[model samples]
Target: MELTDLATIRAVLKRHGFRFSKSLGQNFLTDPSVCPRMALACGADESKGVLEIGPGFGVLTKELSERAGRVVAVELDESLLPVLGETLDSCRNVEVVPGDVLKLDLAGLLKEKFGGMETAVCANLPYYITSPVLMRFLEERLPVASLTLMVQKEAARRLCAPPGSRDCGAVSVAVSYYARPKILFEVPRTSFYPQPNVDSAVIRLDVLPEPSVRVKNEKAFFALVRAAFGKRRKTVLNSISSGLGLEKSEILTALERAAVAPSARAEQLSIGQFAELSNRLEELKNEQ
Candidate 1:
């Protein structure tokens, strides 16, 4: 079956009496060129196991199966299981695991399905759950080596944005701390069955062995990052003080100790600087 063919996809969905759910952000990939590149970007190979999220019609799943030793896809929509089963029947290496990727115990799942094989993740992620999904994978420190995801173009810039750049946000800092991110390529709105309003881009994040920066407390570090970027318009001193509920004097002291200027914006600080400030602030809080 030509899964990327518009007519073929329509016929197949009709045969199964399937309907696209807007709430689920069901836009199946119609561009034949996309899946191959995404699969390659993640370095999917015979020695690797690839975990896929939202395998609409098994288009990318098939591509991964061809390269990886095994492909396990987590599909949240139960209705698509049958559709995937029919489409992916020929691909003996592919397994359609029906569940929410966000809720699943990924470490357990990877251990069970892939055994000791090197693992990677490839997905055309829904825009609505992009940040949460990516964060879950990163925060949990999953065993995956890399993640190749298709996300909104604007989000791609932010996710791959340098920590101290103007495009940087709390998520950008978190992503930077966890992995080395790069934008691989772009996918236009015309590539999907039900076209979206905006264009998309494919990005690859190579998971780091250790965090980009070390902090005394991961909880306090993230809290400070969120607080810093919480009000981008404000100076880092003002924002961190307001967001962390610390006195201006305390925040100023911490910033000075960290060698960060009080007038700097959140976007002006690197991950290391953020970690340094977070550690200093934690020290002061403990002293108090």
Candidate 2:
């Protein structure tokens, strides 16, 4: 049942009569070493409860269960449950749950499976659903200590991007608000079976105890960020004004009050500046 190679994986799939579901993003990892390395990078150990998304064939689950105290491996495909159970039989620390990760209640899951233990997440994310999944864990208020996932190389670059770069966007701003993200490793396309056409990278996101910026009405702050970056090529003042429906003069004054440069583009502004702009906008509203 070892997923060290495609032949074994195919054998296990056939033995269980499990058909791969492409719609669920079912590209399984064939690399023998990546699982162990990902587990180690996640800082998983006997005290940690690891949340695994899409544990196809339980190859990574085996390594995670070995290193982590408990593993709540959520799989979208119920067809793979029998296969995972057989493959991960020896590991008592593993629990394979059948559910769509997006629809499942993460907080409730943590209470039921992890209890009071701190946790980390490790997943070989489906390429098509990468952004949504990453946003769910990082921004949807899951109480995880850290997140380590394999994402498309292009996505990893955009998520962890710095200000003033072409890759930087609303996601970068949103992600930076909650955690300090870093690229952990680059993985070649060959690592996965049915090899993907593009390269991928592993990123480690260390959750911050407090937001990078302490702003009044945090939700509004992100709303403002979304507005600012809504039109990438537009000037900061123009985009925010158009997106938020604020007067150009008011937007300019708020930008100035925030101590942001007048000519700055949304892509050039840091997360701190976005927070400052939110605070300034509130002040402008109060003054009126």
RMSD each, Å: 1.0, 1.3
State the lDDT of candidate 1 residue by residue for 166-259, as single tens digits.
7899999999999999999999999998999899999999999999999999999999999999999999999988998889999999998999
RMSD of 2: 1.3
In candidate 1, the residue pairs with backbone N, CA or C atoms under 3 Å apart (3 or more residues apart, or in different chains) clash, namely none
Q: Among these predicted structures, which one has the highest lDDT?
A: 1
Q: 181, model 2: CA deviation in Å?
A: 0.3
User: Which residue runs does candidate 2 get wrong by more than 4 Å?
Assistant: none
Q: Estimate each model's TM-score.
A: 0.98, 0.96
Best by TM-score: 1
lDDT of predicted model 2: 0.88
Q: Model 1 Cα displacement at 196 (Å)?
A: 0.8
Per-candidate clashes, comma-separated: 0, 0
Q: After superposition, how far is residue 254 of candidate 2 from its true place, in Å?
A: 0.5
